[model samples]
Target: MAARSKVMQLFKALHRTRKEVFKGDDDALEAARQNINAEFRNNLTESSPEKITELLKFGTDVEIILRKTVIQGVHTDHNRISIKPRKEILLDNVPFNHNPTIKDT
Candidate 1:
């Protein structure tokens, strides 16, 4: 009974995190919903207490990672957010020179 309760709690927490993290993105929210449902469904047959505990730990870790990294929100200077760009894009209206030779007199 306790194990079942724990599982339910974890499931609910995951959904909440998804809602908060994927705000303004319906496709992402739906994808997360599907993935979470599929994972829980696939693990329906899991019975061993040890295995359940391990799985729960993994789920918790995943939630923490997603909240800390994937999710973006307003942050302070002390806690800066880092977003990595896939590829460098030049700013609009910026002039680019191919060759530059410095002649010193």
Candidate 2:
């Protein structure tokens, strides 16, 4: 009972992440939606508790990866592309080493 709810929750979270990560791109959204559904459907009959637990954890990891690493780009014109970046992929807020200097010993 509880495990079923957890699976559903993970499924919903993945969908939400897909929408945000693939906004303005119809193809990506459709592909990701289909893959998510198919993976879950393929394992619908698994009854082993250990395998189920591993699968759930893997799903959760995938969701996190999508949220933190995904970025979108749009081809606005013949010669230009526009990048749509979420904060998760932005490095402006992080401390970065912009330059390194070599010193003689």
Candidate 3:
């Protein structure tokens, strides 16, 4: 029972991380959701405690990497989430131009 609960907690954590990391990209979000579900489902038959622990460790590592490095758009600090603007947006000096009308030069 404890092992099952641990797995459930890990699954929830992974889903939350996925939600934060892939906020804007629908394709990446769906892919991550499918992959996470598939991996857990594939391992459902494993009965050994040692293997389950290893799997849980791997999931935690993946979550850490995804949250800390993979998705650079979202910044998380002490449970707070901040959206980071893209490099172009930060580097460009000109204000965003919605419509460019060519004036006679």
| lDDT value, candidate 2, whole model | 0.91
**TM-scores of the models, in the given order?**
0.67, 0.81, 0.68
For model 3, how many clashes?
Answer: 0
For residue 17, model 3's alpha carbon misses the true position, in angstroms, by: 0.2
Candidates sorted by lDDT, best first: 2, 3, 1
Error of 3 at 93 (Å): 22
In candidate 2, position 66 carries an lDDT of 92
Q: Mind giving the per-residue lDDT tens digits that candidate 2 earns over 1-105?
A: 888898899989999999988887899999999999999999999888899899999999999999988778788999998888898887766666789788899
lDDT of 1 by residue, 9-105 (tens): 9999999988877776688899999999899999999999999999999999988776766744433477785443212222357667788788999
- Tell me which of candidates 2 and 3 scores higher on TM-score: 2
lDDT of each residue in 1-105, candidate 3, tens digit only: 999999999999999989887878798899999999999999999999999999999999998877776634444677776665433234447788999999998
Report clashes for each candidate as comma-separated counts.
Answer: 0, 0, 0
Off by over 4 Å in 2: 77-80, 92-105
Candidate 3: regions farther than 4 A off: 72-105
Stretch of 10 with least lDDT, candidate 3? 83-92
- Check candidate 1 and list the clashing pairs: none
lDDT of 3: 0.85
Q: After superposition, how far is residue 41 of candidate 2 from its true place, in Å?
A: 0.4
